[model samples]
Target: MTDPNEVDFAHTDAADRKRREKATGLARYIWERDISGAELLDLPDAQLRKLAREAGVNPPSTRETWTVVAELLDEKSRWAAAHPGHPQATPTHSDEKIMWIKRPITPWT
Candidate 1:
């Protein structure tokens, strides 16, 4: 059985393909910056809800990491298309600190 949410990019129209490419590019940018969906999971519920709103996606009742990532990607893709010249925000100092603290401490010092 096929998954309802699965995107068949191959057969999609040019506009759809471009949209997917933009979203994929957005994901790639985040990953390149060492930003993982796990960091988003650390966000408070209200923040997640706000992210969903900004992304133009209906916030899910359950705060699932993947769902949040998907919604964020969707919003970012649309936002990028709308503002091609705008600079993308990198992980802030606080964001990096949170990720660093969340990492497992190693015994080798």
Candidate 2:
């Protein structure tokens, strides 16, 4: 036998929780932050798992970690060794995404 007032309050509380969850470090935030599967580069397997946990992403196994790491490290190496005229290495496809990602708009948006 819940009162109408209590039910309304519970609904409001649930709505607030969802809003915060969506706005927090969700998958979209991780992607837009330029943190991709490519970030495992050069990091040890343990470190990679720890980093993934920190970033709210599920970690991969050693083999997968090495695969991603190799690609990223190769890119970094190529970029570092390239002459001034060489095309700059792109760490991630989304490297420039942060600037263009639309953030949570104000009520005006």
Model 2, backbone clash pairs (residues 3+ apart or across chains), number? 0
Among all windows of 10 consecutive residues in model 2, the one with the lowest summed lDDT is 22-31
Local error of candidate 1 at residue 6 (angstroms) = 26
Candidate 1 residue lDDT tens string, 1-109: 9999998764468745555554454444443334445565666787656544544555545543344455665565566568767665333233534432257688996
lDDT of each: 0.52, 0.46
Give per-residue lDDT, candidate 1, residue 94: 33
Clashing pairs in 1: none
- All candidates: TM-score: 0.32, 0.30
Clashes of each: 0, 0
